[model samples]
Target: MRAQGRAPTTDGAASATDTRNALDLAARPLGGFEAATAGFTLFAAPLSRVLDVELSALEAQGRGQIVSSPRVVTADRVKAIVEQGSELPYQAKVGNGVSGVQFRRATLKLEVEPQITPDGRVVLDLDVTKDSIGEPTAAGPAIHTKHVQTRVEVENGGTVAIGGIYEQLNRDDVTRVPLLGKIPVLGALFRHRARRDQRSELVVFITPTVVGTQCETSGAGDAEAGKRGPEAGGAGSTRQPLCQ
Candidate 1:
């Protein structure tokens, strides 16, 4: 089914440390950061679009179609899925905003203005430091952003970038195949491994969506959904939620 809606309207990135180490993102501690980033762009982003073109394309191919309600899970939701390691509910949008487009350059991720959403924003963040064991302890190093429109005049409108999307699907092929999602054992296994792995990787948030990593305001509402905060699905560690 197709549903039409106006884009969130307001939304909107970047730097290099002069060289490779400075400009790298995909090379993060992994189960494969780039793969997950790409997967979200292909599988998740299009699905989140108002038109849901990709899913429609699948239906057009005589593929099975899913009858699901339309809801946009916010960044609050993404944090929950990653932190709590839970399955995202059926909805049009997962997380408060759109997952940004991630580009892979060997190990590092080169973010791009998404072809899907030209007006989308992005943010890069990382904080990998050696722990007592000399192992990298990846922490909250996400580059944060927000936008305020300033007219270049009164006619042409060029918006500035604010933050970025957090992509979780690590592989294009895996999420693309609707058939695999239907398999029982395989699907469960895949989801478990995927969620566990997703929270472990680094992030690149594409803006318009704010990182609501807090416990209180992270979408906590109603009796069924509960808090929907970091407590619901948040960093496994003790870091405070960003949204809060």
Candidate 2:
């Protein structure tokens, strides 16, 4: 991540005294005065995914081939799996043995743009997107997407928290008990079924701070220390000026 602070201008800082005076003013407590006439904008966003998996018997024989059944789980068509007939059993398994479940990770992306106002205010524009594969419907595995866009204004040196979006996904698994599990309606008695639901959330946080404020404080502290040097029995010792 890049820093959101502006660089100091070097137009015409001719004298050390002028520089020190500038630092002294910028270090002053906030009131109606402007501190170095500058400020900053901050942006942050959190992305997370929760995955749940459930396994169960489909109340029928678990087909080990890529059948046209909506319950059949396979890789994306773009990267579709091309397995031989001998590999069907291995590919259909959800675990060490063919259990009948599939899982995929969801993706989230965030984009933010910040603008600083003259009165030390910050404006933020945010965009968030999430993508995932949903449960099989009448057709097949459904593609799910969630999007969020918003703009807000915040005072300098302050923080803002914003909510994005949420989504839920599900996966199902099936299993059977040898030949007994295929006895028509009686098959369901020997099989097990399970399901998993995954929920996701996105939250964004932002903070803004003025640039050069740290430098000003350090400069002012050193200048104050120098002023008290003589009183501390260091009258003969020379004190360096701040900011030069």
lDDT of each: 0.26, 0.40
Q: Could you give candidate 1's per-residue lDDT for residues 62-90 as a string of tens digits?
A: 44232222222333112211110112122
Encode model 2's per-residue lDDT on 152-177: one tens digit a residue.
55555554434434445577887889
Judged by lDDT, which candidate is best?
A: 2
Candidate 1 Cα errors over 4 Å, as ranges:
1-51, 67-70, 73-244
When summed lDDT is taken over every stretch of 10 residues in candidate 1, the lowest stretch is: 149-158
Best by TM-score: 2
Backbone clashes counted, model 1? 37
Q: For model 2, what is the C-alpha lDDT against the true structure? A: 0.40
Angstrom error of the Cα, residue 42, model 1: value is 4.9
Show where candidate 2 strays beyond 4 Å: 1-107, 133-143, 197-199, 208-244
